[model samples]
Target: MSGLDIDRAAATQMAQKYRNAAEDLESALGGLPASVDGGIASGVLADIVSTLAQNAADLAVLSRVMGGVIDATVSDATATDDSVSESFGGLTLPGEEAAP
Candidate 1:
């Protein structure tokens, strides 16, 4: 069977990119106000913006969490791979029988 092939470095880079996107989103949304000073139209616009901001904040948090999860998962996978490799250090493959 074909084995799993994960690029640990690429996964790490993707995780970092997610975190960076989160940071960028939060930074961009930091100064938006919940309410504005105009009339009914302004109030409606503010409400929309407020809702969007909240959703964006939630998305940012999710992105950061996903990044952390990816990093942790990759680390765990690497550790498990290392442990498995070590466990099989002296073993021979099925077809590579030793001379009697």
Candidate 2:
């Protein structure tokens, strides 16, 4: 009902779409061998690999977007009376802090 709710819904839809796309790509790849009578040509295989890689990249972006949306929604829900720092614990870079 709210803007945050809308964003969460949209993110969920986008994630589902990306999952569908990935499944379709996998199915297409599975069918490739059947489509080619003999073994797949080197050039054709290279092209297929390139396309698959791009699809994978898209999936990654979609996943990241979904995660960001969830994070935003959570932050918004918890941020009414708190500072951003408090709402999100604390920011720390991967290698900036030593492991405990």
Candidate 3:
């Protein structure tokens, strides 16, 4: 973990929490009755529930995408860190102390 940038990991964890919430909401939606009470307003209720389910799905997808972005960002950062270390490894400027 030395010299590692943790912001991307934190973002990935946040996105995972949102993904969990979306899954929970979708699970709850699955248990809803087709028609509560009589048939009146059932269609509207169903449509609302459907829209909510779709929104949850969208949120899950978005969270996943954010996680991917975080992973990519972390990977890029690691690569840059490696490149910088290699470029400066064992190199000393004039009048500067060399790292042991």
- Best-matching candidate per TM-score: 1
The residue pairs that clash in candidate 2, if any, are none
How do the predictions measure up, each by TM-score? 0.83, 0.41, 0.68
Top candidate on lDDT is 1
Q: Better model by lDDT, 1 or 2?
A: 1
lDDT order of candidates, best first?
A: 1, 3, 2
Candidate 2: stretches off by over 4 Å? 1-40, 81-100
Mark the 10 consecutive residues where model 1 has the least summed lDDT: 31-40
- Compose the digit string of candidate 3's lDDT tens values, residues 1-100: 5655567667667757766765776677678776555378877877887777788777767766676676777778878879989998989989999898
Cand. 2 Cα-lDDT: 0.60
Worst 10 residues of 2 by lDDT: 29-38
Question: CA lDDT of each candidate?
Answer: 0.89, 0.60, 0.73
Q: Count the backbone clashes (under 3 Å) in each candidate.
A: 0, 0, 0
* Candidate 3, backbone clash total: 0
As for TM-score, the candidate ahead, 1 or 3, is 1
